[model samples]
Target: MNTQDAAIPSLDSDLADGAITPIDRPTLHSVVVSRLRDMIIEGVLLPGTRINEGQLGQQLGVSRTPLREALKVLAMEGLVELVPGRGAMVCVLTAKDVRDMLEVLSSLEHLAGTLTCQNASDAQIGAVRTLHDEMLAFYRSGDRLQYFKKNQQIHSALIVLAGNASLAMVHDILQSKMRRIRYLGDQNDDTWSGAVADHEEMIAALEARDGPRLSAALVDHLTRTWDRVKDAI
Candidate 1:
């Protein structure tokens, strides 16, 4: 192997039974849990896909101990379902589950937006606007991945602006559940332009400090987005 090639683990070597280097982070449990969670959300591990503990634990380079604990966390998050003696698999959302989750998410976001409108300082609004502008430029550049990353920033900023710690915590949890479904929905739905427009309107409402208007806009935006993807579920 060349110097560079020798520096990196060979694909075959890394896939070996004992190839996983031990993680040194103190919070290894959460890291393992988060990696598995992202794989599930990104559809790398499809919904209803049976999780092979041995394969997964090996692939992730951890002992089965941490992998099992990670699966347990996912089960609590509703991303994975535990089957007695059968092990865990990604949770499949029925149409009803999708509908219920969408409704709950929309309502909660509406509440958050309303509270943000009431409580956000001018500086917070300015920050969101800056992020929105950056998003617009990134979208114009046709960089969906970059835009998606910034899209996350904008949402998190809004939640922080809400000035409610509990609501922010709730949003983080809900966003994890919605991530996979939202990706599928966004992929099939052609209403991204409308969605962006709605976001602009949301900004306007916030700028105006109109609590009621922001709340209504959030609900309408989430509902419309959900409707577009509901049929696919």
Candidate 2:
């Protein structure tokens, strides 16, 4: 066998050892979008990086059609900007951009707090608690990526529980816009710990179903987010 072939682990051996498992693959567009998003968030493709479609398509083993489609989706989410001549560029946030979005997001979440405390079923609240537990588990295991995803999910779940489609939609856009900065900000151990403490307070207030208290906590969390992530931008 050639050296490349020799290095390949045998599928039969993996199957025999129960090390192989079947998994459903995501759609082409979804996979491309996810990979591109990760690359941007991890700084593999830094902010203001102009996307070279042809080269990127080759690297991703995809065609221009799917790549373009994925870029369109990302643009809508505010993670990438579509330029007239430049194709696509990763979105760059100034400190001012971060501040503006976080301010708006804080107000939205503050509103969501009252609505959620009033409208959410016990089951809905419990679902967020479950996500919090899972997030904490990921944090304990030092799985930062999974923890970050779960953390976002918990916030989104609260917005969802508010039972307002508009709030959820806007929150999603803002969350996507800030994803990379938030991930980078938490790189500090002290900042990450403070964030966890903030979440603990949030969940506690939520479980108590105290509208004012929950709103206070949500506002505090979102407002303090600026401090946690300001240096990252």
Candidate 3:
């Protein structure tokens, strides 16, 4: 077996061991989509790299049908590009694409900050604070991947707090596109410190329920983040 294929856990074995339950069809599709999305975002599958359907299917321990379906979903999300006669490749973002996406993301986060401050329950805000603390711990420990994941969770929580389903859906799509670039931005020590400071301001604004301040902070944060990552993109 190939290295990638060998690395995959057997689904049947996992199921038999009660490690993974037999999910419904739709849920299984979602799982496949999530796995492929993560693989791309984490750089396991590099940008512009052509996808090998057979090898990937073996690596993921999924059949060809579900893998193809998952690739379609990823294509719709702009994480994969389907080229005629060339099959699918991971999407490569141009500098302009990054700029455009960050602009939209900044606006969305601004709205999220405004609505979250106005609408989020005390419990929800507290939960976000807890997550922020956990993220900080990851940062302090120098666990970049874990820190990035928790950072993502905090942003997602803010969207959830905004209580707008449409906003949440749009934000998720854009966020997926920017994940890898943002992760790379944090690799610089100065930029990473600045991001942590920005998060601190975000938490403070949330705690004070200052909608306008939080909105401004979110916009400024995203702008500076783009500044840090633009050259790399």
Among these predictions, the greatest TM-score belongs to 2
Q: Model 1 Cα displacement at 148 (Å)?
A: 4.1
Taking the tens digit of each residue's C-alpha lDDT, what string does model 3 give over 149-218?
Answer: 8999999899889999999999999987788888878987899999999999999999999999999988
Q: Report the number of clashing residue pairs per model.
A: 1, 0, 0
Which digits, one per residue and each the tens of the lDDT, describe model 1 over residues 50-96?
Answer: 99999988898999999999898888777899999899989898877
Give the Cα error of residue 71 in candidate 2, in Å.
Answer: 0.6
Candidate 3 lDDT (Cα, 0 to 1): 0.91
lDDT (10s digit) by residue, model 2, range 79-160: 9999997799999999999999988899899999999999999998999999999999998888877888899999999998
| TM-score, predicted candidate 3 vs. hidden true structure | 0.80
Tell me each candidate's TM-score: 0.73, 0.86, 0.80
Better of 2 and 3 by TM-score: 2
Model 2 residue 63 distance off true place after TM-score fit, in angstroms: 1.9
The regions of model 2 sitting more than 4 angstroms off are: 1-25
List CA RMSD, all candidates: 10.9, 9.6, 10.5
**Which rank order by TM-score, best down to worst?**
2, 3, 1
